[model samples]
Target chain A: SQQGEEDPQALSIQEGENATMNCSYKTSINNLQWYRQNSGRGLVHLILIRSNEREKHSGRLRVTLDTSKKSSSLLITASRAADTASYFCASGNKAAGNKLTFGGGTRVLVKP
Target chain B: GAGVSQSPSNKVTEKGKDVELRCDPISGHTALYWYRQSLGQGLEFLIYFQGNSAPDKSGLPSDRFSAERTGGSVSTLTIQRTQQEDSAVYLCASSLVASGSLNTGELFFGEGSRLTVL
Candidate 1:
């Protein structure tokens, strides 16, 4: 069964706009990581936020984790056309052999 | 000078025929993983290898799917009697370790092998 589910299956915005995507999981996790995929290719690791950390940032990406809510959100500020891709949140649980359970993902389109 | 690599980048095979996909993890990476992504969907875990420990093959969908990692470096996923449903992008990722710590969750991915079982 899939542990994580992402919201807003698709999003469209102009360049320089901000985009927000949400993910919700059913079980506890040691950490959650986000990844980006271009054109259905391999996924690239974006950022990882531990259960102890409420928020994290890298480049123009900001991620927030709320254990109590079992949800996380990824925000892309000043989005560029290059940022257009599918974003996924993968949850890592201790009982799951440290394997990542990925969400269906959110596809973002940035119009230049 | 290196990252995880997979080949062939694309493959097409007839139904009932077997196919093999290869993955080469980055040197010194202790953990390797195989995942399958169907059209417009999230990745489905297939198998995992961590060092010399027994591989975790719980994610394989059926007995038709099998994988082996030789020398703890290159791994191969073989599907016998392929079905059209098996057509998907097979992705390989490797990480430095298997612990779920904040720093260990980063996974380096390969370009993936696209399998089309017709």
Candidate 2:
């Protein structure tokens, strides 16, 4: 079963605009990670935020986690055509042992 | 290999036929995982292997789906009596450390094996 559920199944925006997506999970998580997949192939790790963390940023990617609400959000600023891809949120928790369960993912399309 | 490697990038098989997909994870990585993703869908966990311990197969959808890891290295996922619904891209990932912990859950994925059952 998938632990996380992402909102706004799809999003479209113009270049230089900001894109935001949200993810909600069922169980308590120890950490949350975001990944990007292009062309339906391999996924690349983007950023990770621990439960104790409220927000983090890497490059133009900003991630915020709210353990109390069991949800997280990813924000891509200054979106580029290259940022067009499917983004997924994975939750790692003790209940799942040593594996991270992914969500349905949100597809983002950046139009130049 | 510097990264995870999977063979048979694409495979097509008829219903009732058996197929096997291989994954060679990054050297010395202790954790490996398998996931199945249908077209434009979320990834479904299939299995997980942690070092020499028993694999976690709770995610295997059916008895026909099975996997094995040898010498703590290469792993193979096998399917028997293939069905059209089984067609999907099977992805393999490896992490440097066990997941579910801080600073260790990030995964490196392979290109994946696209399986088509006719």
**DockQ top scorer:** 2
What TM-score does model 1 achieve against the real structure? 0.97
Off by over 4 Å in 2: none
TM-score for model 2? 0.98
| Tens digits of lDDT, candidate 1, B1-118 | 2999999999999999999999999999989999999999998989999889899999999999999999999999999999999999999999996746556668899999999988
- Give DockQ for candidates 1 onward, in order: 0.71, 0.83
True contacts kept of 1: 0.67
Candidate 1 contains a number of clashing pairs equal to 0
Q: Candidate 2 local accuracy as lDDT?
A: 0.94
lDDT by residue (tens digit), candidate 1, A1-112: 4788999999999999999999999998989999999995789999989889999999999999999999999999999999999999999887878888899999999999
Residue by residue across A1-112, what tens digits does model 2's lDDT show? 4589999899999999999999999998889999999986799999989989999999999999998899999999999999999999999886778688999999999999
lDDT of 2 by residue, B39-87 (tens): 9998899999988889999999999999999999999999999999999
Stretches of model 1 off by over 4 angstroms after superposition: none
